[model samples]
Target: MKTYDSISAYIEACPAEHRTLLEQLRAIIQKNVPTAQETISYGIPTFKLRGNLIHFGLAKKHIGLYPGAAAVEAFKEALGAYKTSKGAIQLPLEEELPIGLIEDILRFSVAAQTKSA
Candidate 1:
């Protein structure tokens, strides 16, 4: 599997169509969690504040957002329209990226991590 040293490198390697979406998602994460450290974890771009805040990556036909199980459950209603598993949400490439929802999730993650820390 390919490995990435940084988030930018990971985004750079993605297909052009997905690149813009990933960049926007990265920006949303950064704007919401200004102090979180960015790194590659489990082969995906991850944000760490008190701990693992969130992770995101390009999927075959969607962008996968990993915010852990609790966060997924907490936002279940808001996430109903998307595909979700235990700790991941798949935002389809064809749809307009949910910037507001992504921002809310990032904020929720930051708050949750901060409280547990």
Candidate 2:
């Protein structure tokens, strides 16, 4: 496994095809959560506010999003088109990114993290 010190480093290491998508995603995340700290956690680009807020990464065929298990379940219906696990959602690379859904999930993560902290 590799290590990354920053979000740009992680995105730069992704495949060229996914680089732009990841950059756009990162921009949306930053625009939505301006106060969240950006860092590499668990070898992925993670955002932290009260704690860990959300994570995103480019994989072979998809973009993986980690907003924790609770957020996944909360937005299960809206995420029907994507492949989701207990704690991660796989957004397909060929399709357009669901920016609105992602922002809603981020809001859920922020609210939950804030309450716990």
Candidate 3:
């Protein structure tokens, strides 16, 4: 995969149908973590605040949200039908984005990062 220097470039490389969703996701991230340092990490769009706060990007079948293991564990019960791993959540392309759940996760991430710092 090609490396991206900016989030816009990464989003641009995604399928045209996914761009709006990716942009919405980016807006949510910015709204929730206004102080975060946006950058590309692990070849994906990432937000940093002392450490890596979260990483998100488009995928073949879903948009991957890497909020690390802690967030995944904290929100596991609320995850319901979404696919999750140790540190990642896969939001399928076919479904509408869960705006409320996403906001909660983003807030939780910011709180954790703040407490740690």
Return the TM-score for each candidate structure: 0.96, 0.95, 0.96
Per-residue CA lDDT of model 3 for 25-57, tens digit only, reads 899889888899999999999989889999998
Where model 2 places Cα greater than 4 Å from the true spot, the runs are: none
Which pairs clash (backbone N, Cα, C closer than 3 Å) in model 2? none
- Candidate 1's TM-score reads 0.96
> 1-117 in candidate 2: lDDT tens per residue?
899889999988888888899999998889989999999998999998988888988788999999999999999999998899999999999999898998899888888987887
lDDT of 1: 0.90
Candidate 3 residue pairs in clash (backbone atoms < 3 Å): none
**Each candidate: how many clashes?**
0, 0, 0
Instruction: Tell me the TM-score of model 2.
Output: 0.95
Off by over 4 Å in 1: none
Q: In candidate 1, residue 11 scores what lDDT?
A: 95
| Model 3: CA > 4 A from native | none
Q: Hey, what RMSD does candidate 3 come out at?
A: 0.8
Name every residue pair that clashes in candidate 1.
Answer: none
